[model samples]
Structures are given as structure tokens and as C-alpha cells.
Target: MALSPPLRQHPSGALARRSLLVGTAAWCMGAIAGCTSGAKPPSPVGSSSFTGSRTTAVAASSSPGPELPTAVRWRPGPGEIQPAAKLAAVQLVEALGTWPNGQSGVRAAAGRAAALGIPSALAAQLAGQAGSLLPPADAAVIRVIDAQYGGILSDTASVLVVCDQPTLTGRTVRPGGTTVDVRLSRTSSGWGVTALHPAAPGPARPLDEAAREVFAQSRIELPPASAADIRSGAVHDSVLHAMLQLAGSYRLSVSVVRSGHPLDVFGTDRPSDHPLGRAFDVWRIDGHPVVDPATSRTLITEFMRAAAGAGSYNVGGPVQLTGGATANQFFSDDTHHDHVHIGFTA
Candidate 1:
């Protein structure tokens, strides 16, 4: 029988020391100097300590020493294919997180350009004469997409990216012939951008690299829903995300149920919010609703009122509503009494 490919070893100094110990006492002793200090170390209260050499141990409460860099290995995870695509996604996310929030004018615009997956070199192109290029929301959107997508990408794909841009007025546009070349590669730290090229040729084929990157970053073991399910709308996606975020924060599970009714639709009454996919009904794992009817109504109202304090596309669940019920909530009536309607922007 053939031997299986070896799993990637954790980058550990201990492993290297162990490897050096084979067949030679001197090698063992030399490699394990921490054990040969000639000093008697303390043992557990009930145990004994003696001997020529002893291994030193870190105290339980001690902070771990610096970690070694992980080595690259190409064993695929559940949804992984080629590894390069995954790396591209990681690169984009890392770059986006570098933007500082709260600036204005040219700085803001430059941040937006960077968020749109613009090359670093071209980031300056988006700067406005006054200050920053992007507003807070745009900067935030970029950060969200990067973090969410980066967290989801696969670990094998390789990628490279460029984020430079020169400013023209307050907008930065990718120039036709001056496009930067981005490249990436899979690494132990996940995908890393390896190169950026300018005045280089572009790919002749469609770069599903974007999709591959997104998929790699967010790869999960579950089978994807059907196309129809995906097409249900961004509203569904937004609300579900809010539910997940809320559930995660509380370390709880979310159960969803549809409110059944016609013109009497419980809370807010817009067909799109329910049937067409603007709202969600979240419950606990035990099948109990997240809140009682009276509480839910009050909570929903409060949630919408608080939305102004949150990021865009942030309405959903019991505690994590983004604000503006009439805008975020399409329906409010008796049908939604049991389950809280987690609504999202239209």
C-alpha cells in the first residue's frame, strides 16, 4: 500500500529538536539544550525529579513564545480547488482593513478606491482635492466585504494584488491601459499577494478569480443552495447575516419561520419584505420565538430606531437591528407575532 501524503507539520521548534535526536545521543543532547542546563527543575508536588538531563517546561499561566512561520503545503480542504484563487481573496481583504475610518475628502475617496479592489498604486487617484475620497459608509462597506470574504476563502489559492491609484478631481477610475497586474499565492498564513505588475499583459480569459477568491475565503462544507435560492435577493442575505451575527454573539442558534397571512401581515405590510424576501423570522433552537409578541413589537420598534447608530445593511434578529423600522421593516402585523421579523434594507 502507498503511504499517504504527510500532513503539514505545525511550525514548531520542538519538532525540529525531536527530528535531530535520531540515532545519536550527542545530537539529542545538543538539540535539547533546554534539558541539559545541569540545574534541577521542580517537579509536580507528588512526583520525583532526577537524572542527567531534563526537559524544561513552560508554566501553565505563562504566555507562549513567538510562533514559527507555518510551512506551505497543498492539501485541499472541503471546497478548495486551485489555491491561487484563494490567496487573491485574502490579499484583497488585508488591504481593505488598512484604511482608517473618520477621515474626509481625498482620504475618504482614496479609501473607497482601495475598497473597490483597486490597486494600491492607484489609491491616490481617488483622493479629492479637499481631503479623502470615500465617505464613512463606503469605507465601511469595503471593510465588511473584505473581512467577510477573507474569512470565508479557501486556504490553498495563490494571489497577488496592487492597490495604488492617482487622484483625478475627487474620483479615481481604473485607466484602460494603465491597469495594475495583481498576483497571489497560497501560504500557511492563508492566501498572500505575491506580486503586483504594471505595463504587463492582462488575462485573455474571464477572471473567475474573483468568484474563486470569494469562494475560497468563505468555503464551507455545506452544499450550496440552488440558483433559485441564491436569486431570492440580497435582502434575504442581509437579514440572514444579521441573524447569524446576533446568534454568534450570544452563542445561540437561530430558527427561521415564515409569517403566514394576507393583508393582515403582522408588523409592517410589504409583500416584498416577506414573500419577496425583505424580512426574516428568527426563533430559538428550542422552537420558542426570540421574544414574546408584546416584547417583540416593542423591540422591533426600538431596533429600527437604533439602526441609525449602525452600519448599512444591518437590520435583523432580536438585538442587532440596524434602525429605521418603516424603512427596514416592510411588514408588522399579527402573523409575525410569534417570530420576530428581522428586516433588511430594500
Candidate 2:
């Protein structure tokens, strides 16, 4: 099998982090094009303390971007692709999905994208997709949970943007969100979004005990698509049980579950544990993002070990760890560098 391909050049530590912290959609859409600052990237966690299989080719970069206005939020981890590319992927979602009171429709959404530098025609095409997805009245807010690579090579990239959305209409507020696979093409101007594919969650089904517990735990943040996966009873109880156990110690910012992820592992035909509901990915732990070089190794190591204790058959994160019951219980791979993956066999 082909291992993760080597990057032609590892970006200088200085350029590794270029994107900046942002709060509003207006700022994010404008910043993604070229507005960023140079900073030393957080140093990588070494492989000495962890173990596992299939090191993914993706590297973790801690470039910050737009965040929610509320205490409840999610952030983009360092991405597998270029920082600008990932930011653009996230910014496009924000521009299209968010709006203020009295503004909700294709015209409003398209206008936001056009202002963000997306081509006017393409912006309209993208906005045409909103349909009933956008609430007709009051304000709609979308919070990006994480932006990881769906695929990347040469000039094309697909970023899986997992997020949660809430629409406040008068006194009634609705909780909702979706996973959008944003496709971008390299352009002279910068990364340009070419398409957006949103996840279609199945109708909600009865939740099992573990699922119910995870839902009740606000600290265990779940994007709308993943919440639906658990609600549909599609996620395995073992996965839910482990999540609840993990939630006991650390606040988990889960990125993907059964929905909005490829059915198989990124570079292989081997069926992924996720689609089977046997695994989950955490982009952030206790407010420290795994992709951030500044994140403490001890924190991640303890969490991975805790996952193993919670009965995960496989635990993958940014660095390799020691003292696993099995030889490969802990691992670090490129794709997994930005998040901690807890996978169970049962």
C-alpha cells in the first residue's frame, strides 16, 4: 500500500501559521484571501510516548480562524492542506450559512459570497442550494467545529467542515447544523471554493442509553450531523459508552461520527470504524486543539490512555504513546494528527 506521500517542502515554521483569530463572518471571509500574520508554529509532539498503525500523511497546523460569538463553539484545527485553503473552506461555509434578522434567501447568501470574493455566478449557484436550510426570519448562526481534509493533491482540495447551527426566530429558537464538504481550486488570487456538498442526516431515531448520555453532556459538543447519527441509533453503543467515559474528564469537541465522513479510511479500501458507528474523532480536548503545537503532550497522552481504559481497541492522535495493553493501541498519523480518534472493535 502507498504510505502518506511526503510533502515537497515542509513549510517554514514561520509560515506554518498564517491565519489569524477571527470572530465575525465578515472578517473571516476577507482574511482568507491573503490577510494573515507569520508566527512560529507549535512544536510537534514526538512519537516516543504513543503507539499505533498507519501514520497518515496529513500534518497538523494550528492556524486559527473564525469562531462562534457564544460560549458554545468549535474551532478549525491545523489542516492537512495549506492554511489559506482550509480557511477559505471554512469562510465560504460561514458566508453562505449565516445571516441577520430579516435576511434569508438565495439572494442574501449569494451577496455574502460575492462580497467574500467568490465569483458572482458561482456564488449564486452555491446559494441556490440553501432552500429551506436557511430560516426565513430572524438570525441564523453557524459555528464551524473543525475543517479537516476530505482530500488534497496538487491544485484541488476538499475540506470537511463540521459545524453546528442555530436559528433564532422571535421567541422560538431551533438547534441545527450540517457537515459541508467544501471543494476548492487553486487560483492565482488564492484558494477558491468551487462546490459545497452538505450532509443529509437521516430522520432521528430512538437513542440508546449511551447516546442519550452523550446528548445530555453539553461538554461533549456534537455537530448537528453527528448528533443525528447518534440519535438515529446508527452509532454503536460501544462508541457512545467510550465517549461518555471520555467526557467525564475532558471536554470533547467531536468532529465527525457516522455521517459526513468517508466510509473507508482516507487512503485505503479498509472500511473505517466510523461509518460502522464504532469510532469518533475529537478535534479539541479541554479547549486545547490537538493540531496546535502548543497543546500539551501530557494532556493528549492522558486522554488517549483514558480512551484505552474506556475500552477503545484503537486510539490515534498527534503523537505515539507507550504502555498500551496491545502493541498498536496508540498511534499518530498525518490524517489523525489534527484530532484524536477513538475506535472500538465491538
Candidate 3:
């Protein structure tokens, strides 16, 4: 397919590639630290500002390559959508939510303050907000459930992040979370967050309706955190829409949904999409286990294809398929042997 006019005009490859490299390197460092003897495993880093997992490959030559067949073709609006800027927005929001009582811990979580070009005064103001909201005796964990680009104009961008905030005292409990609007500006260093606020309340999006319906059916059971998030509209609309569509055809046995779960991809430092509510897992389709030999291979194959058709860009299960809108969009992993994972992109 032809590139969007804006994507065609702007230089984005270099910055995107750089962002991916940095994100991967950071994951590696965290992983190595976790395995060291006597070293406490580090907390999983929040989603990288650059999300390499979600990408669209552009054809290099005029002849064009095989098109990624999809129900909807992903398009970029005018002006380059800088991955660095999106990443910075995520990082800044995370930093604001993760402040602990101590100055050192607060500084670590908000380390990107300088990179985000936040003035010292504004940074102090943010710290004050955090201090008032959280108890010093308890640690607060902020998980980004999904982030969507609200708008992008030249060097300025607006992003909306749906997140869950759980306080860890004797036990972890999530009261609820809200959608936050983060505004960022491009800088020599990269994207820097300049302003933050709550998104204005509005009517339900497609995903919100779907989530409510699925949960109401009570046929698909959800993990507690996922249930709470669904009730609070913390799950991303895209993910909820995909699930609702899938559920219409097959009875789904859900495994994970959002918070109150592990935050990283198993054995890797890369943040899992579950926390962002952009992903979900189904262990059974129509009462058949995906990994069971009794289950028909054709059944699993069709479901995977249908998932992609339902707007999921990433699908994983016991079986891997080829020839989709993108190569390797359908994958298989040992961790996914027992279920099917459907992931959406912002």
C-alpha cells in the first residue's frame, strides 16, 4: 500500500530505530540485574516510550511489496508520528505516578523529568501532587494499560493513557484509574512531556460497550484485577472491542486482563501488554483447550485468523501461521502453549 502523505514526507525511520534500540538495551540491563546473585530482581520497567512490538513496515520501492491484508488499513495523519515523543509521554506519565516518599525513590521514578523538559518548579509541583495522594508508608505502583495518540502536530503531541494505580501496603489493591492526557514537545534530546491532565468524560467508545457486555454475560470469567479494571473502564477500547467480537462467535475462557498481574513478559524485562489492557488471553475457545490434541488444528487456525480480522495486530497461540497483513503477526511460544493471546496497537 502507498504510505500516508505525512509518513511519506517526514523522516521517521532513524528516530524510531534508535528508540527501539534503547528500549531493548534497557530491557537487557534489567534482565541481567535480575539474575545476579544476591541481587533483588528489579521492578519491571514501565512500557518503553518506543513500542517496537507495534510497528508498521513501509515498502521501500515503488513496486510495493505484499500488502498486509486487514479489515482496516492503519494510516498516519499529517506530520510524522514520532515514536520517541510517544515514548516520552508514557515515561513522563509513569514517572508522575510512581513517586515514593523518599527523595531518592521519587527522583528515580521521575528521572525523565529533565529529559521531559519539565521545569524544576513544575517538577516540584508534580511531586507535591504525588505526596498528597499517596501515603509515605505505602508504595504506589502505576501501570499503563493503554496509550493512544490523541493528536500530533509537528513537534507537539497529545497522548491519552489509561492506567491502573495500586497501592502496596500489606496487600495490593487498586481503587481505580483514569485516562490522563499528556502533552509533549519534541526537543533535541527527544520528546519531553510538558503538561498533564485528566481526559474529559465522554460517551462510551466501542471497546467500553463491548467490555461491559462481555462482563455482563458472566460467561467469561476474568482475573480479579481484570474484572475491577473492566468495571472501571481501565481496559483499552480497542482490546475490549476485539474481545467482544471474538466472544460473539466462541465461548472464551479468559486468563488475564489487566492489573493485579505480573507486569513483564515472562523471563524478559519487556513490559507485557496485559497491564496496559491492550492484550488478553483465552485458554479455551468453545470449551476446547487450544493446546489439547483433541482440539482440531483447523479450529485454532480459524480463530487466529479471525482475531486478526477483528483488529488485533498480534495473536499468539500453540500454532503459528504465515501470510497475513504482516509476517509473524501470528506466532507461537511455549508460554502461550495453553492459550491464545490477542494484542492490539494504539
Top-lDDT candidate index: 2
How would the candidate models be sorted by lDDT, starting from the highest?
2, 3, 1
Q: Tell me the lDDT of candidate 3.
A: 0.49
Candidate 1 total steric clashes? 68
What RMSD, rounded to one decimal, does every model reach? 22.7, 10.7, 16.4
Q: Which ten residues in a row have the lowest lDDT in candidate 3?
A: 1-10
lDDT of 3 by residue, 221-273 (tens): 45334565676676788877777787778777664555433344533445667
True lDDT of residue 73, candidate 2: 22
Runs in model 3 deviating more than 4 A are 1-208
C-alpha positional error of residue 160 in candidate 2 after TM-score superposition, expressed in Å:
2.9
* Pairs of residues at least 3 apart in sequence or in different chains that clash in candidate 3: 49-87, 68-325, 69-325, 145-276
lDDT of 1 by residue, 1-346 (tens): 0010111111111001111112222321222232111333333210011121122222121223321111111111221233235334333322222222233345544453344344444444323221211223211211110000111123321111111221122222121111122233344433334332221221233324322232233221111111112222322445444434443323222222111111112112223343334443332222222333323345455443433232223234334332243454333322222223444455
TM-scores, all candidates, are 0.23, 0.69, 0.40
Give lDDT tens digits, candidate 2, residues 46-162: 111123211111111233442222311233333343766777767667667766555667888888767666557777877775443464646565556567665555666556787
Question: What Cα-based lDDT does every candidate model obtain?
Answer: 0.26, 0.63, 0.49
- Those runs of model 2 whose alpha carbons end farther than 4 Å from true positions after fitting are 1-81, 128-138, 150-156, 187-189, 267-270, 322-328
